[model samples]
Target: MRVVLSCLLMLLFVPDWMGEPRLPLMGKRAVVRAAPIALDAAHPARSRVGALVWLGGVRLTSPDRAFGGFSALHVARGHRVTLLSDGGNIVQFTLGPDWRPRAIAFGDLPAGPGTGWAKVDRDSESMGVDPRDGSVVAGFENSNMLWRYTPDLRRALGAAAPRAMAGWPGNEGAESFTFLPRAGWGGGAIAIGEQAPWPGGTGRAAFRFTGDPVREPNRGYRFSYIPPARSDPSDMTVLPDGRLIVLNRRFTLPFTFTNTLVVIDRGAIRPGAVVRGREIATLAPPLVHENFEGIAATREGGRTILWLVSDDNQSVLQRSLLLKFRLDAPGTPGSARP
Candidate 1:
């Protein structure tokens, strides 16, 4: 009886062992080495009007507004840009002739079970648009829910579409996702989670979905895990070469830490690929406003440009900062590469 009691106590008191390591905290006073650049003003990367443009650091109107929690910002081939707010709102901003945001429409997302408008409970993180059909897929934070919307968004604008994917274990919040066009391996989709259960760490994952969206079990889908500890990945973009560039934010005191950029080679990720990762760039709090969340890649005058944004949390101390960088490759920038 004593042995049995001891075993129970051990189970209760132990740290709940998981296979993954705990994410490290960025200690206070970490300097942000990257310089801040104005997003609206003309610069080397923004001089051309017809080139692909990347912008960030726009302030939110209110604390409840999704402006600060910009999790996903995507530009389609036709020059259409859609931004998804993690704070339960989807804002569609049309691009003008010069690639700048023209008209903006704001709408609420269908509330799921155990969700609220407040930051403490809201989800709705990353989003992807179907290149072939213009359909939308959104991933919810703190829940294992993946929603799909047909091109008829006007009819089902605020309504939650059918669940296309699920079954993520733990408090794993699906944050960002990008789709690989039908090239090979059946044209798969890649997603990143803020954190996972056994791993007790944050990382990015890649998935291959069966063409069918309605059937049970969703056959032919697989996951490739990339372990980047203490790195809460909020967004991801796939480069032309197939490498994944992940934007990660660290937590030190609930809402403060350095933001990091990581690059994972295409071959390094596969089913059960050991999940190790390397950090290429670290953005200190001072360099960027609080809560840098979204990231995207585009071409500007034959140069590859990387854009990053911050989630201000609607706090006075924070500002939405959009910064741009010129990249030679996924992990080749001097500020980002180790």
Candidate 2:
């Protein structure tokens, strides 16, 4: 009986990680449940939000500890949405018209800068997908690095830490990124640092990589972006017709975050040029709000759809939300305009 008790105690002390030195949900299937939510809590019928009309939204949650902290989002070919977390975790799923999720999956990045033993080693804050080759490029904050991965994110292709981003603070590096295809610039990428202001601190530091940022960091050049007052740029996407969409977020009292969407003409972006975006929509007050950090654009028929996903930060006081909006005011983004 004494030997049996000793053996049981030894089993309890076994290393939970089994010395694998990895993060959780390593390509493991994760189930996410989303409850329907409306744009206006009190007035559910009010859908008009600036230039956008609410199509649908939901509060997303998961029982797994590896979920949440989704800092970046990508919707590919109008078929699937991929959520990338700051902790190197990923959730991919298809959302139906009814707002239900199908073919859900959860995974972790296979490789990064560090040994994968610490959270900061995988502090990937921004991501962009290459439409030409289906490769994924992720920007890590604490390490201030960029990594290119396979389409499935199951393997790493290349990585680089550009000189243009070398001066950015560890925590404020490359918080927003997007692949800008042939906007008269021969298909490059743009990255925005969250709090790293440009020049005299009037705007955030932005960069345009002339090619694959991970593969060709040398061609990156500096630019300046001035978002709306009191807001920080979170995520960015290029419209189908070459316009730029940027998501800016601000923190409010009593623990909540507000969001604003801005549009910049593609021509406004240039080396050494200080660019600003026109505010088109905002989510605040009675409207559904959270720490929205990710945004994606897709086309459905003749409408350009905007999707937003929130970063919960893995806190009980916060919430993860997925919102869908239809561009109603018209203009670029291809099919969205007449």
Candidate 3:
């Protein structure tokens, strides 16, 4: 009887992740329960056309423990999106006519160079898809490394830790990883650190890798990016026209959250140039904000669509939110055209 009691106590203390990882099933579909959420309680389901016109938003919940903690997002080909979580899981789903998630699919990264057991081992904070072949490059924070996967985001092809990104303060590493279409003088992939300040400089450290960082780690150049005051860079997306949209996040006093969207010209991104985005829109209290960590952009007929998602931090006090917006002023030089 004493042996049985001892076994029960051990089971109770066992960490939840001691079980198998929930890897993505290629053809399987999962369901994500969503409740319609308003961008602002006063304005309700809509946002005004300033820099970004609010479309609508939803609070997503799932019985699956693997859900939430979304760190980065990518609008892939078709009407589908690929979301990476801090838990080392990947969720792919198609959007229906009503802007709700449909045909959901989920999986874990098969394996990576870190080989750690916890989610932080795979802590994939950022992702960029290769347009030519649909391949993907994911940046893991705790490990301070990047891994490339096939288009389906299931298999690991290669991995690398760029020499320039050494000692990047662990959890702050690779917060924003993106691909700019013929960007820079010769074009390349870029990764920015969330809390890593530039050496002997201000702002954050951003790196431009000439080729695929996972493929060619030797060709990396460092740059500087200054986000809004009291905020840290979270995620970034390259627009269809080669513009860069960076997402900045802040945790205000009394447990409030704020987010800002800033745009930078494609021409401003040069070696050693300190690039600062033009603040176009802000998301704060009464305007629908959480730990808005992920951002992605797509172009419709005559409009540019933006999607913002929040990380619940897997905490009961927080919530997971997915928001949609449309950029109304693309030709404007700075900020949103009023």
Candidate lDDT values, in order: 0.54, 0.85, 0.80
List where candidate 3 sits over 4 angstroms from the true fold: 1-29, 183-185, 331-338
lDDT rank order: 2, 3, 1
The positional error of residue 197 in candidate 3, measured at the CA in angstroms, is: 1.3
**Candidate 2 — which residues are off by over 4 angstroms?**
1-29, 199-201, 329-338
Better of 1 and 3 by lDDT: 3
The prediction achieving the highest lDDT against the true structure is: 2
- Tens digits of per-residue lDDT, candidate 1, 1-338, equal 99999778866875453323222112222121123354334343432111222343233343232345566766654444455666655555554443345455555555442335344344667766655667776666655555666553333333232232354543555666766566543455666566553234223444544452322225443454554566667788776566677777777875566776667776665654445545665665334335777777767667666766666654566665555565654333333322
TM-score of each: 0.66, 0.90, 0.89
- How much does each candidate deviate from the true structure in C-alpha RMSD? 12.3, 4.6, 3.6
On TM-score, who's better, 1 or 3? 3
Question: Candidate 3 lDDT, tens digit per residue, 1-338?
Answer: 99999767766875544555533222334668778877678866455635887777788877776678888888755769787787677777887768778878888777775555556566888888876577888888877888889988768888898888887887899999887676443557888899877779779999988876777876967889999998999999887677889999999879899898888888788789898998888888777779988999987776788998888987898998888888866565532643
Provide the global lDDT of candidate 1 against the true structure: 0.54
Compare candidates 2 and 3 on lDDT and give the better one: 2
Question: In model 1, what is the error at residue 118, expressed in angstroms?
Answer: 7.1
Q: Best candidate per TM-score, number?
A: 2
